[model samples]
Target chain A: MTLNPNRAAGATPLVAMKDISISFGGIRAVDHVSIDLHAGEVVGLLGHNGAGKSTLIKCLSGAYRMDSGEILIDGEKAEIHNPRDARRYNIETIYQTLALADNLDAASNLFLGRELVTPLGFVDDSRMEAETRRIMGRLNPNFRKFKVPVAALSGGQRQSVAIARAVYFNARILIMDEPTAALGPQETRMVGELIQELKRQGLGIFLISHDIHDVMDLCDRISVMKNGVLVGSEQVGDVTEDEILGMIILGKKPERAGVN
Target chain B: MSDTAEAHGAARKRSFIETLEIDTRLLGMIGAFIVLCLVFHFQTDGRFLTPRNIFTLAIQTVSVAIMATGMVFVIVTRHIDLSVGSLLALCSAVMGMMQVVVMPQMMGMGFGHPLIAPLAILSGVVVGVLIGAFNGWLIGYLTIPSFIVTLGGLLIWRNVAWYLTSGQTIGPLDPTFQLFGGINGTIGPFWSWVVGGLGTAAALWSLWSARRAKQVHGFRVKPAWAELVMGGLVAAAILGFVAIVNAYEVPAARLRRLFEARGETMPEGYTTGYGLPVSVLVLIAVAIAMTVIAKRTRFGRYIFATGGNPDAAELSGINTRLLTVKIFALLGGLCALSAVVASARLTNHANDIGTLDELRVIAAAVIGGTALSGGMGTIYGAILGAIIMQSLQSGMAMVGVDAPFQNIVVGSVLVLAVLIDIIYRKRTGGFK
Candidate 1:
């Protein structure tokens, strides 16, 4: 199925990844996929494992380079060669594996690359810890073991630290890959509220998930991919949960969802 | 440290040491050190702790200890530089050639020209840094494993050193350079006390300012008395070391020779002590500078972070490849610095200078609690590790133990220290 590759008439998308394709070892992990996100919107990217959902999002997150594609940020071409470049565009990612330095403390992990520094150019560890505490206080008030390395924390605690790192950074565009895979149900709800909060703050988020209910609950639009191809992109109200699942499972296009 | 201890503190009522916020691991190491000293003192008929012997040990540890400080970071990053001993020899040879052969022949600058020693030192350091950068480039850019690259360096640099000197010893170095060797240059008792006072002041001020910073940040601060007591303990340690070193008096015969050389008469009962050797002072400065780098600087942070998780560090925007080059380059500079102290101490550069020193440095860093797997080390720990290694060897020698037997004991001690460190980390729930 040919997905529509058009921009809104007047409003520019906060991020538009156009015609992205990449391969590894003669296998097309992501092939000619295009997606866009607007401010104050949550775009759910749904697929099974090895369905190219992750590979496609990784291009915009700067974890992978597309074979041929260009990323436009707010209608301007953006050059994202690395995670550092992606960060410069105020883009932050919370990977499925969390991508945290396990041996460092919560504050150190949060400020790993861009540390808060004193006037004398030393890492202002105290200020960072305080800020971490302030943010965690709002995210998870029970997070008292701030001083230990994340390696020592429980699964849920570690999840919050990863979440707090992304949330505290004030990212204009956020990418989350299976963020709730390690989180408890309560924590999952907390993240749902966080997504809502970030949405009202006018940030664009790309939430990659397999849970249809979660997508329907949190996302405004859903993009489903199968075998390195985008099968459909549909509004939450315009589609039912089963139709979205069919697109995810059988690579059904949006037009066929209406016919069936 | 405050890192994990605060969480432990919150869990239950704290112990005395925990309340004081002292690292239990460091305290345990210190305890072991003192115990080792006491046993040696008994075996050596009290000779081990005598002022003269203690002073000698301090000077002897300087060369290896300086290199060990750099080795901590190297090991912390899970890389090994097996060429340090060879690098030290090469640096010493370069400095020697600069002083005895190159300076007079090329620059036409004869001995006692002042530029000879300074220029020679600079040349040695440049060679070290350049070679270090080359090694780093191979490991970081060429994607060669550090172990293989440095292992090759161990053999290559040693041969290079031999070729530079043509298997000969260069001697009768610039007289001023010998001062760093300890006997020729000693800051007298007065200056030692002054330095001690300044060190105490710095320690106190640092402690106070840290407390102030904590208060400003609204984090949990330690009790005021705990800070005061810790400060007092550090001050006492610095002052005590100075006092012990100051107790070693210049022999009357040597004093008389000095007076005669100056054409000055020696007065009766006019005695003075060699308070601290300049080499030891240099090690202290290196320790301070390395600690500051490890704790305060972004470069140091990236190193540990990379060691902890290279993927995470890379994703966090750290240029880890460039950092590797810088780390090795820093280590090479330190090796050159060690060469300076070593060659100065020998009063010449020798064929076997710095032989087997790479093992000693790696042993020191590992003993100091730098995990070989990567991502955990401390500068002070490495220095203490060097000290412990030196003390064990020297004490065994004083008790008439054979050289091979001394090596066996030191080797066993290194293994035992790492075993203990691993168990402690496992028990304490530290990073796996």
Candidate 2:
């Protein structure tokens, strides 16, 4: 797939993490990793299991505290002590498990923490349902089950709920960890379309997955990490699937023109 | 074209069946309650349906039902309160000692002083809250498992209650204080009708407003006739209860009738209706408040979320530990209220009061469809469950069943209810 790099050469990156490091029980899980994301772009993080890709992204999502790192949003230092702080900075994450309450309906799950309430301080279900419908219409027009609990929904519909929640909250930077891991091919295509729509709206996304084909098909730039270190970052148009695979398994950068 | 039409019709029919099958456990409870009533009515030669009998049954259900409403929240958040029965005993002991022994002696006033009643109740509830806060802190902030903490509480609180009275029964409560628990202290017939009518109106208004909101939002809603039928059913149930209570004549009028039958003159101005019992009204108010909390409040939603998945709830910015503390404290307050009602009804605080009541309260919640595994329940369902349990005990007693057999039957019914709940969830594809 041909790709055009979305980050302008001189424009400030949307987010930058410098020398982020974290350890678990005396083992370095993520060490000295630096990465950046830009608006209107898709950056794919590819690695093997336990390669520290998830741990690294978790720091940005505020699920984990990095041992040493500086995070900058729009070239300005940002402090994220917890998930609430991350949300305040317009950073929403869609974990592989989706983190939804299984027994609550779609609208309830969508507004789980930040519920809409009336003047009487009661949860306004009707208003929340309306908002959910409006957003789902934009993200996935075919989604119709608003009253059923998420446990009753198909995998793709559950994903739609998770995605719609992130997007509806005006998220500027989204981190999706293996969004299409359990989906069928058709659902995977649907997620791809959703990501493309999000990109068109100028939201920067960090797509974390082990699927090389998905990265080639959807990402503007691919960042490969192996054993807690960044192997290399390359524009998709400048690297082949074999070379990316080589970087993932062998932790070796391909000698490609104009690649860093 | 014909095939397509047939397929559409079948799909519509299937959806209708699906809607009917939703919450089958609730439907099962309703069915079981009706069956129990019929059996008791037949077994007692129609005495079970009498206004007098029904009134007593409602009173009997109120104390446990009140606690069950709070239990719904506790169990919904994946916790248990084995200490409620003991808590009730302790609160009642405190109230009795304050009203009957301490307050009168300290103030040099008679026990019948009206001030004594409210003061005793307040102190009782305050003590309950303090104890509950202690329990909440241990389980929530200290990270102790609720099961172990509450199990320990069950033993400790009961011992404290026993120690408070030194195994002596406190009795013959003040007349003014007894009114809260006695039948003669009930509201009159006129006010019962007024309250019932207002309750019906509120129910209808809520239904209509919900429909209007759905329409305004352009969301799919039930058909107009379906809503109308639901409203009518609720109204009938409320009106029927009022009619039953109104049928019971006052004890003074009955005494006057007996005197007249003996060919003697009767006292004038002895006319009155049984009206509604004070405790029953209290239970109704608690039920309404709890239902609203469970269905429409953020705290209620957090309870369910915490039960559904603690990790997700915390990651969503909810403080699950703090929520746990608040829920336990609320349960404690409910326990205090139950103590007030129980003590007032019997006009005494005995060592055996509230014995084994925690088991009954938990059974009622489980029968009402509150899962022990957590994440799903309703306050109304818990109330109905309490009614079902009381009905069984009342029916079996009227039928002259042995006490041990009654225990066996009640235990079996509880196990059967949970088994049915599991099957119903599986049939409906609910999360286990």
Candidate 3:
């Protein structure tokens, strides 16, 4: 596998979290860690369980507050006190749970927080459905169950709703936690195609996953974390699967790799 | 290729079955209501379908139906209010006292004044809202489970009613106040027909606009014939109701016969028509308003969303706790309105008024298709559920069914409705 040669050549980092730290109870869940994502790039976050990768991403998604850290978006300091704050910065997170209201139809769930309303303060459901259809045409052309509750949908289609929600809201930075974790091979490939399409549209994505093959196939760069600490980050072409595995289990960088 | 063709045919049949199953529960409820009416119509020797009996049944349904509409909201938000009956009683007691005792004394009027009835009803509603707000505050802000809070309220509020009236019935309410709940307080036949015509127009307009909007958005819509069929059904239902009431005229001959039976001479030119009862009109207005709130408003969407998934709703920037409070408060206001209707109908207020009514209200909502576990319900369904419940009671009584047997039947129906709902959910892939 080879990385795109121009992956990180001249793009400015769109989001940077410096020395982020957080603790649960008396234990440090995430030790001092720093990571940056450039515009139009897909950065894969790989880690074993309890490695604090999710917790670290949670801080950026505004699901958790870091004990000590500063986050910069587009080189400006950003204070994200909650999920709404993260949304204001055009950052949307698709949690592993998908965070969808199961009883609502696709258009309703897509506009759950920010509904389209007529001048009379009535929910403009027709307009919302039309918009959902337009966006789904681009993201998942096969989607057709617009009126059924999302709970009746397949996992892949539900993921499409979640993705469409984030993307339709003009999100520039996306944090997708295990986007392909519960999908079949076909669905995983579908998500992979979606990620590639999103990348082409110049959105920076932080994809947290344990699937190394997925990381290699879709990510421009891979960052591995172990025990709440950064083991290493390398351009995908700069290392092989064995070296990435060694870094994950042994908590050491490959000797031949150039530091990213 | 033959196998593929067979599979396609089977798939189409299966999809058709699925759509039928999806709609059958509501259709079943409607069918059950019609069957019940038919059986009772035969059992009563045609008296059950008489306009007078039907009008009386509608009036009896108003109080329960009004509360059932509110119960849909309460239950949709994943909460239960067992205190509604007691709340109604207490509000009735307060309103009765204000009209019969407090207002007269304060104004120094020897007889009840015209303004006293309206003032008393307003106070009753205010008291209802206050109690509802308190319940909401505890359940929403204090994070107490609604079941425990409202259960505690059931005991406390009923006792408060008993204490307020000192176990005595307050009686002989103001004549004008009694009109709000009386049979003669109905809109006349002419006005009833006018109202029915207007309602038919509104229904057709709404259907046309919805179809037009869907088409404008380039979405799939029902055929024009389907819309026309629906509009025709609504018009028939409304106009039929008006026709029934208009047919209930008290002929001068029947009046003379009654006067002779009572050993009195008949008066000249005595006549009457039942028209539409004022209480039924109140119920209809409440149903329409609640339907709008449940279908169109942001608050209504929030209620469903909160009931569907509290965590997701919270993360989506919904102030779920505040929404919970608002829903409970709305329930309270409805309880007050119900109290007014109940007290007016009786021309009196008693300690036992509205006792066991909470059960009936809850039963009506559940029967109508509001999920007890929440997140799915409709106002029209609740009203129909109320109708079914009252029909069962009235029909059984007319057929000389014992009181205990009536309870047994109603309880079994409630359980059956919920069981059907569960089966429906399972068929639909289990509660989303």
The lDDT values for all models are: 0.88, 0.87, 0.86
Question: Candidate 1: which stretches are off by over 4 Å?
Answer: A1-9, A256-260, B1-11
Give the lDDT ranking, best first. 1, 2, 3
TM-score of each: 0.96, 0.92, 0.90
Best by DockQ: 1
Model 1, residue A252: C-alpha shift (Å): 2.0
- In model 2, what is the error at residue B356, expressed in angstroms? 1.3
lDDT of 2 by residue, B33-146 (tens): 999999999999999989988888999998999999999999998889999999999999999988888888876877688798889899889988888888988999999998
Question: In what order do the candidates fall by TM-score, top score first?
Answer: 1, 2, 3
Task: Tell me how far the alpha carbon of residue B63 in candidate 2 is from the true structure, in angstroms, after superposition.
Answer: 1.0
Q: Locate the minimum summed-lDDT window of 10 residues in model 1 chain B.
A: B1-10
lDDT of 1 by residue, A1-260 (tens): 12123324567889999989999999999888898898878889999999999988888878888889899999999999888899999898888787888888889998999999999999999999999999999988988877777888876677778778777888999998987887789878887888888877888899999888888899888888999998878877788878888788888775645311
lDDT of 2 by residue, A1-260 (tens): 34435564767889999999999999999889999999988999999999899999998888899999999999999998878888888998998887889988889889989999999999999999889989998888977777767887788989989999888898999999999997889999999999999998999999999898889888999888998888889889888889999999999888754454
Query: Which one wins on TM-score?
Result: 1
Q: What are the per-residue Cα lDDT tens digits for candidate 1 across B1-432?
A: 464555555677767897797877889889999999999999988999998998999999999999999998888887999999999999999999889888977778877778888888899999999999999999999989999999999999978989999999998788877777876778989999999999999999999999899899877788988988999899999999999888999999999999999999999999999998998898999999999999898998999999898998988889888989999999999999999999999999997999999999999888888899888999998998999999999999999999899988998999999999989998988773
Instruction: Please say which candidate is ahead in DockQ: 1 or 3.
Output: 1
